[model samples]
Target: MEEPGKIKLTIPCRLDHVHLAGHAIKGVLAETIKDSELVFLIELAVCEAVSNSMQHAHGCNADCNVEVSIFLCNSELVIEVTDTGAPFNADLLKNKQCHDPEDATCEKAAEGGRGIFLICRAMDEVKYKSFADRNILTMRKTIKPTDRDGEP
Candidate 1:
């Protein structure tokens, strides 16, 4: 069983393991959150975070580890994705615009670079930091009272 208000999942830095993180988030939140859409959004944000950490940070090396810690506090759900690989420039997050899949004229149109944009759109608040040798991406979402089946 998971702890009362938090759950942490550590997975190898590989693309195949990304889905595990997503499923774990959905399973934990689905128990108390009745809204499927909200749960899906959270899951998507987390999966993108994990994928970015694995591909960009760890370079898809399975020898590394990515830790995802999720906390349910009062009316908010906070998720932190931590990795010991290369640190990123958090400032880039400020410039990400939501990528419209249908915009053919967009100069930046590509298969990548949309992770940060999607994450920002899904969560209420997003933060990124690097200290010492670790990089952590923290995302927060406010859960309205009606979204939960019971008090968090």
Candidate 2:
């Protein structure tokens, strides 16, 4: 069984193992997140971050590891996705920002250039850090305390 407030998972940097992170994360969220809509949004945000790292950091290579750490606090959930790969520049997205700001153009967004935007849209907070040896993307979502059946 996973811990109550914290969950940790590491998987290969490949599209195939992405679901492993998702499945384990859902188990944790199921215990805390009482709203189905919010659960789905959180899952999507997590997946986007993982997919981005897998694609950008490792170039879909399955040899490296992508670590996902999830922390559930009183009324919020914070998740971090970390990868060991080439340093990334978060400013790239800022430079590619669309006039609308919230999302890039359909052409770019549809081409998988909007992972950051989609993550930002789905979660309450999104942050990125590229350290000397690792890249970490953190996302947080506010959880509404409802019944155990995931009803608001």
Candidate 3:
């Protein structure tokens, strides 16, 4: 549930576009938010998600686009990223396991493919959907007044 004065921002999916998204999130938090910790958390989460799209979703192709939307509603902040890249096997993520420290797989040792894991850990809710050639990821974080009061 968003409060009465909810904020919404939408940006196109270009590598250059993330700067706009990041700026929007920071601007809103600075202008209206009173809690520093919560503001930082939301901003970081947005960065990770957008970075995933900018870096991985296009596989280095500069022509592809990724759409981003952010909204602050009553007690929740919602962010969505959508891309038209080839459909990915979401199950690959669901079944992923941490590699053994002694015998890490070559793929696991690589710098890619960790975004989903980070998103899962950092956000309260994560969902993926594919429709009409687009991959949509939605993430939410619950904001409590106590979260601002320094209560764990």
The ten-residue window of minimal lDDT in model 3 covers 93-102
Which one wins on TM-score? 1
Clashing pairs in 3: 1-74, 2-73, 2-74, 3-74, 13-66
- TM-scores of the candidates are 0.89, 0.80, 0.69
- Cα deviation of 133, candidate 1, in Å: 0.2
Q: Between 2 and 3, whose lDDT is larger?
A: 2
Instruction: Please write out the lDDT profile of model 2 over residues 43-137, one tens digit for every residue.
Output: 88888889888988889888899999999887777899999986567775453343334555666444446677667778887778887788988
| lDDT preference between candidates 1 and 3, better one | 1
lDDT of 1 by residue, 33-127 (tens): 99899999999999999999999999999999999999998788999999999987787788656464665655656867888989998999999
Model 3 RMSD vs true structure = 4.6
Model 3 per-residue lDDT at 43: 71
Candidate ordering by TM-score (highest first): 1, 2, 3
lDDT of 2: 0.79
Per-residue lDDT value at 147 in model 3: 56
Q: Quantify all predictions' global Cα lDDT against the true fold.
A: 0.90, 0.79, 0.68
State which candidate, 1 or 3, has the greater TM-score: 1
For residues 1-152, could you state the per-residue lDDT of candidate 3 as single tens digits?
74465455544556567677777777775654667766776677677777676676676456666676767765677778787776666774464353223477776586666656666766788788889988888888887766543345
